[model samples]
Target: MKRDVTITNPVLQGVFPDPSWMWHNNEAWLVTSSFGQVPGLPIHTSRDLSHWQRRCSAIDEEMARRLFLKYIRTDNHGIFAPTIREFGDAIIIVSTVMEVMVDKALADGADPDEINRLRAANGNFALVSRDDGLTWEGPHWIKGAVGNDPDFFIDADGTTWWTASRPSSSPRWPFQSDIWMRKLDTERWRLEGPERIIWHGAVEGATWAESPHIFLKDGTYYLLAAEAGTERRHAQSVARSDSLNACYYENNSRNPILTHRTLGEGFPVQNVGHSDMLRDDNGDWWGVCLGSRVVEGYSFMGREPFVFPIVWEDGWPVFTPGDALLRRRIIRGQENTRHGYQLGDIASQEGKNETDRDRHIEQINPNDYLMLPTQPQWIWTRVDDFDYEVLFNPTLMHEARIQQNRDVFASITTDSDSSSVVACISNKGTVQEIGRTALHHDEWYSVRLVGRSVRFAQVPAPNCIPNTEHPLLVGKGAAAVESVAAGGWPVINGGLDIPDSSFAYADAAFLSTESAGGYIGCLAGVR
Candidate 1:
């Protein structure tokens, strides 16, 4: 008897979100929301655009420098969902952005009441880069609202159009979304296109419409929108328009074409449809979407990118439902290797830290993973996608040492700093500050762990950060296990269920304030 194995599609894995794509000349250029992770748009350029190989990130430190003062505030904008296009000789993309800072209300007004109220809002907006998207101009004003999971389309007649979800638009209208529209203008930096209310939940509860894209095929303008919220499951709905000027109505079915139950077999993804569709050289349809990885059977991170294949049926689109639990190989043996990447072993250790350009560390996850600056892009917290004002750099971090517990190691690391500094907090939340040390460059660095003993030195590339503390040449030493367990951090509930025991795994990242003014990357190497 011959046995057969079913294969899944997204050959590559991670928490990918808000899929966006562009077909340039003969190459397929695409962008995705990297989320709190540094580096905007995990752009993969493909000759075929089907089988993709990561090339370079569209947004990075250097690019940030060229455009930092132009679009949105650097510290607060962790490049949200962006839209890209080819204008004349160059390619461009704009980001819906938010930056953090002390409340303007506080500065402008004498009233403490009004000032405190304004501080709580996380402002969302649109930013554009005229210099081929490498350097942007401004997040200007596209109306103040929670505009995310946005995208744009170029009309054949040369008019540029836009779409995004006003996720909170339903508070008053029940099932309504501000499917915004605008024209692309070169003379002016921001969207000069006259904006309008293209669509609202005219059908069912468009409760949360996301990633709305407009495409033309066979003289029909097909508008595909992801309906339902991000968790549970997401479905795509389609609407058609005979003219760009005419109002496009929702497809009567008004339901999701795909569901988590269909895609998430046993362990399929919960929600799956803030998608951007792209066509490969071969003409096959593909989409990039946002979903969570749900480690430990619980949702932790906000949303990530999910790539899948798309099929068209009589003017509508369809996607393959995934399994609840992920199957090892999305596609087996077909994983042809170009440049191989390795995720090495990690361990919990108490160590001294040092960094310089030459002294760098690797991330435990895929080396390609990068951390953004602490001011904005790399927002972190006890909250998801937190703003910049509240998110500070962790040039220094604190932690108390408990029993040599296998389950409590956190993967942590800093950007490739010419010099690095980090420390620990004791059981009493007492802070220990480690001064600046030269960072190792070229390859990623890591902590050398041997049980309670820890040393930080330059390892090759690709690894996570260590969380234990090491005393300076002279000072208070690491506390006892009982002291650590008492109050440092509540006894981590599942402190014994990690998949790896041999090597301690680390992923907690807190950046340093030193990299604030200049152009330095605060990268995260996720395993």
Candidate 2:
């Protein structure tokens, strides 16, 4: 008799992006891109990758002390994508921290070489140690240029090696780049051999590939790299070699192992690539990567993590459309979640009272919240980095729009003082901060969205349009108004409403809707 089953995604929900993993002893350590613009990268751990909890970050104050003494940079300079590997009794990490690119360079133009050099100058690379994988140290460079998409592995003989996109020292031109590798002495953490270029691709129209994660399985070394481009045209490919340091080439058995279309239309966005693969403690395989987001019509460079479940088929890994969420638990556990929905009481009740909570909660309930087919990255925030968590239901919205009749649903929670709950609305990329009368206890808040044209009953609506000259003067200094694309924001009922100071509205599931643009917008802060 035949049997049937279902798969679930986002093994680690909420902002756990660009994931890579390694097993040390009996425990599994997972690392991901800590695009410090929002929150630091979180290292998740699990006896089985299915049930992951964040352990810590690849960068912290103590880590800074161990790597570079008195090292300081805004959240932008610390760390970007990080990968982990265990060598014998020692565990090491390879990281890249690309300084945040500003709008000016993106505005007039950007020379890829200029961008690369500037990004590297502000970048830091290193491998650190921790008796407990919770914290890391060592800013030691591996005798090469600062590279992106770094992943490492070890042979049975305890030989440590590193492979990264554009791993060698050279200015990257259109598509004239390659993935490079080097053998390193485990003790000193330095490169040994002359770096070798393992593979290369086109550099003109759609340029070089990146984010290579290699794993040795079943006598065949499988190499997975981000190919195509990282825009609406992201893709992934697989290659193999008999030896790790030897010549490895694309399998050619299949052109693209995966593509943005293969994943299906999810979350009304595009641009998905840059992945890292890993094996769970239970011997299951997974891949995590980043994706660009489209909301309404505008685009955002979101660092989303996608998990791809792996199974060997005819000597290659194959995945189902559902198993292709960019992120999916290899297996599900029967462990009952103790965290229940406490914010449900006020969900439908529209009032002046503010709702807040730090943990993620779905609108309505688990039954009403539809988890998207594509797995989504999840993160837990403290009062410091992100202070609020929110949920909203567009289905519940009932309002009139100036142009169109559309409502966006999502949930929100925040950590703020007991005096007020900050609420806001984004009009043409400009955010108006308003406040509500009530503040949630334990730093949590909730908002039930009734309609796109609707406003919170307590706080009145503000003019939706922005003022003249893009002059949004903050404090005493005059700052140019950061323009948000009006063409991309989802069309909704008109006018701006500041019911409360700030609130967050997120899709309950990965790829919540086919909104034809960015998924949602949120905010959390102390008032």
Candidate 3:
């Protein structure tokens, strides 16, 4: 028998979270949470789960401004989990525009008028696109749907069911929540009929039971939900019942079908939850979920989308069968390709040189650049030895920062007069500048890395900054490292671990989750 080939995990990288998967038109489609990122509700398509490409953002500028950006208040406060489904002649998406709490806003002395406006704008809503998401219609605020992570389920008899999670109407404990359902009046664009609690949770004292998705198979209703919040203790559990509106019982044998909470903080993939499932053309079950790659307790990259193989036994789903923990790689075969999938060598191809890699880069039209929102979408290259000249257009004056993970390795502020470089590190939430240097205006400069030391020079002439004799900053100071470790987080002693040890950088470890101090990852891009 031929062995399956190994492929990288987190198929969709760089902070794509709350992934919802569905099979439509014989292809795999996905939508993930956008938080504060604009041009929100990104839709991705994959012929085979192994290789995926972005189609277009389902939420456009007009919709984004009207529904989310107008009232956005915090970094992780907008655009929560979105569920995409093919309904009738159009594709519909159900999501929530989360806003600051009214009490908190009032306490902060926010204008009552604005606070009321924000409150009116917040809540769960729906959008439909008939032209493959090129155009959209109706943010039709679902009148009765209350809570986050709402999902749409169309029953066999053509009845539409809306499922969501919210704090219990009458709470017995703190953070107690329940999953409930109601008949969705699709034509009227609102939820109709009486609401009923379907499942409390899989376990006692489970908190924040949200991200509810209902799956029906063989005269049974399987309700999947995420509980314990989306943190180190995040998890996904299942409950089942014969009827849609009746109470469901937990799958006690395997309550939490998936989670990384039991693996401890040392494990690489942490905080795994908010999962969605689908079956491929080959009838094989697969799943996608949000997880983070934690390096020494710091997860700077934030929650990313990871794919896993799933199997059903006794009417329940098993994620990554036989594996207790999420792996960095998985074994797959080419035989599992979808209907129109042309198998590629992506799984086994040798690494390409940068020049060879550039050929595959998608070229975006210059006009389309205007439509691009100011999100931290980045292109990264990791290396121990790099020599490149960066031309900072004097007229633009855009401030760009260089990072070695969460640490601010250096920053360049350019203006018409001249540019200055500041080498810095972040301690707790405070930024401390370690050194500074000045460069001639409109001059081409080269930055090179030799081991842990970063050197700067004027191009062609090789004149170093200040005078021609000194390197910019050597990795000599341990004060930054000491301060960071003392700040009460696990510190990776040696440098950042490059999975491929072909390169090494000692201070790369400083760029981590603890140092970043936000829900999002350390970003490197021009704003």
The TM-score ranking, best first, is 3, 2, 1
Question: Per lDDT, what order, best first?
Answer: 3, 2, 1
- Model 3, CA-based lDDT: 0.61
TM per candidate comes to 0.57, 0.58, 0.74
By summed lDDT, the worst window of 10 consecutive residues in model 2 runs over 471-480
For residues 337-419, could you state the per-residue lDDT of candidate 3 as single tens digits?
A: 43222223232222222113221112222222212232333322222111111222222324333343333443444333434
Predicted candidate 1 versus true structure: per-residue lDDT over 1-527, tens digit per residue: 11122222232343344667767767666676643344556666655323677655665655443223123444334456666666556665655444533344245443454223322223333344445444554333333234665555678887765566774543565645667666644343235545565665435456666667788877778766776665564656667778764555546363455545353422323555666676655455666666543322333233545555565666666554332222212321222322111111111111111011132222122244344453332212211211101101233232112101112222224435445423221212233333234433333333322212222333332233332121111011121221111101111112123232222222221121111211111222112
Residue-pair clash count for candidate 3: 2
lDDT, candidate 2, 1-527, per-residue tens: 11112223335433444667766666568776544322244566765444566675656544433332122233223355677877555567777655344344445454455444434433435556656565566556555444677777777666777777753245355455577788766566556777777766422233557777777787888777777655556767777787888765646466466665553433333556666665654555555555533333223223345444555677776542333433222223322311110111221221111122222332222111111111112221211111122221122221111100012222222224455444444343343444344543322223323222222222222222112211111001111111222211122111123243433332212212223233222211111
lDDT of 1 at 403: 9
Q: Which ten residues in a row have the lowest lDDT in candidate 3?
A: 479-488
Give each prediction's root-mean-square deviation over alpha carbons: 13.0, 13.8, 8.7
Error of 1 at 380 (Å): 12
Q: Model 3: clashing residue pairs?
A: 406-511, 407-511
